[model samples]
Target chain A: MKRLLLFVPSLLLAAFAFGQKAYLEDPDNFDPTQPTKILVDIKQCDCQRLLGAPEVFLWTWEPAELPASDPNNNGSWTSSNPALAMTNEGDDVWSFTFTPTDFYGVGADAVYSTGFSFLVKAKDGSGLGGGGCDEDKTENLSIKPELPEVPVLVVAGFPSNLLPQDVFTLVYDNSQEEKVSMQNLSADEVYCYASAFVDSVEYEVTPFFQVPNNAALQMQSSGDGTFTLMFIPEQFFTNVPTGSTITSMRFVVRKKVYLGTADQVDDPLLVPVGCP
Target chain B: MKITLKYFFILLMAAPLFTACVEDDTPDIGEEGSKLDGINATWRLVEVNQQDDVSFTLETRNISDFLLADGNAPQITFNSADKTYSVDAKGKLNFWGTEGSWTFDDDVAPTNITLSPTGESDILVNLTATIRPVDKFLQIEFSRDCGGTSIITYLYKYERAN
Candidate 1:
């Protein structure tokens, strides 16, 4: 019996580490004939999953900044209806569906493409009160573009389910031959800050920029550049429940823009939320 | 055989007493100044090396025009005993006249210690001090923000207040 108990925990850990199912599909070859759509499916057997996952996910649009009404409706396909409740689909497959909106936004036309990703978790039975799950856990799905594709930029990695609270480290690498500039947007949450690579440089602005919560380091590209940005929680949103452990984090890096211009409003690119 | 077994049982039961006595006799093995717990105490930001040979005061109040415009001062607190410190986590450590968190990298007894700001890559202050029994004074070199060393040096002295 004692051996069985140990076995159960080991199995549970293995399951947690490799427990969830996640994938993204965008029809094949940018199919111009059909509306460009990015589809996502994630599910977990664990019971204590986080509730009220963020629905609105945004990413940097090409050409950097865009008008308030995105000129090119990058063929969005995600529905903004509502988060669906988990159903017992056979042997415990708690699932959800995601449809990505057009790149140009609500309406417009173009190849409408930019690189982005997602953060997800296995549903443990905490908030639901099933009592048979672990709630404080997180996972991520990082998507990158290969050669011939435009550079895959990293925005901000923040917590979506502001439960217990969270800390994150974002690594920015400027391996490209050309120099690149970066910025962060914490979605108007003060105290959310980003600390760019260690101490080589410092970038501070009045009214913290909307990049990541902890972004302070800035630099012109040194050859083959790499930077690690860290995100530490200084406080929480009003909606977050007290005593709830942060399960995961989410945020975006609006597209990078030249600092010399007055037109700096750019589309923030999305990435899977991460927890460190 | 039964007597021998009884004696074995008694010895086994008394083993803990012997071990306890031995442990009591052992001395705490630690180096001269390597003990963090002994040196643990509250430290305030005494002074910092700033531009134009100016010695910047470390206040836990919002005093900057920009910070006041934004509302708040750059305040820093150092509690070495607890191994924790606080800086403006909003990526605005510079507004408080410093960068990131403060680190007590190494503590050398008799007068030398290395401290650096948290989240910074370059070295900030390499302090050489005169460690008196009660009055400790140190000469500090500050790093320039715009790619050069501070022409002037800032000195700070502390007494065992706590």
Candidate 2:
């Protein structure tokens, strides 16, 4: 019995050191807060089972206690936000990217992830799984895990903004995970923006900001990972010169960490406005 | 106090009864509704049936050719007071409604209608139409016998744009 206990700890310690879904290969390239992409190359599970693409659920929480804290394992390991779901990129490789703002709801005085964990459930939920060690760290908290592999950010929803006459609407591909798009736009009274799926994370993104154009924005969550965005165009561009037309106006999701300190999440939603 | 309570109870009991008694005695429109009530409202093209085989009794010259062009579905709004119709495409009224007059013909299934432009009297000869009114739609057939060689028929369907 004593030998088995000692052997288990050794095995767990090894898993902790080498077990990571994937790491941010280049966290310095783009805004880390945005729905950034990370090419997560998944390594073989300790279980030695032939791995397939699994539905990854990210569990982020403020460190408070150990396994003894949430003994029932109800709230701690619960699956609520599908925003962290991952996509399998064939050849035993997978991709997981999203705006942490969409998942973590922390603000200026917010607590960063004292600990974050990924629960890779089989796409079938067929009683098979892979996560942290089966040790007492259940109550332990971590800001980041030291898994062997590194993961990048993945995003969803590519929009084609084809607004006809009076009615304006956007369509996106919905056959993916926690997909988010920022392409819904409208032209009404003031320069407004309709950003969708905003998170209360510090240094995150707002719907729209003053970028030369007289722009304002509003957002409402819509069906199947979609957001309806309405925007106002610059008055000058509104009635552009006969031959001139406005195009490729971008709005991103970012949060304000401080007065001059803020960052964006994931990718930006591109739209076209102005000139008839 | 007792009287107030009794009146309050009576008012509550009578409220629903009075509400149910309210009725829309303003008369009901026909199952298909009236087409002339909105004679001046904007009408938009929804469907067209252009057949090149019919009688050439009234001069016909392919109106579908002018309509169903590249972009923007065509629409026409008639000004009852001025007796002039305005045609708009892509929100701009610069296409075809050049001071035209319209009159309703007496009928049932296929309502016979006439469209005559003031200056172009020749167009008035071929613009007379027998329209089928179906639930906010006016389906008109522009047919010509082609003087015996071949008959051409073009069906243009329009709906309320507003």
Question: Please, what are the lDDT tens digits per residue for candidate 2 over residues A1-276?
Answer: 999999999999879644644455344443324565544434544432325544443333432222323322213343323444557677655565754433344321122323333334332332323543332112222234222232322222111221111112222222232333322222221122223221221111232444214232322334544333322222222333344333434444332221221233345555443222
Candidate 1: deviation at residue A234, Å? 6.1
Model 1 lDDT per residue over A1-276, tens place: 999999999999877544534322332343323343333233442322533343322222332333535443222223211232323333323333322233323211122333334333322213333233343222334333221333455333322211122233343443421223333322231122222211233222212354433234232222334433433332322233444333333332222332332223133323222122
Estimate candidate 1's alpha-carbon lDDT, on a 0 to 1 scale: 0.34
What are the models' TM-scores?
0.20, 0.24
Cα error, candidate 2, residue B32 (Å): 13
B1-162, model 2: which lDDT tens digit per residue?
999999999999999989898986887664653345445567788665434231111222233323455556878775555556766655331223355776655423325456676666412212233332334665555433323332334456678665
Candidate 2's DockQ: 0.01
Cα deviation of A3 in candidate 1 (Å)? Answer: 61
Error of 1 at A241 (Å): 3.7
How close to the true structure is residue A256 of candidate 2, measured as C-alpha lDDT? 20
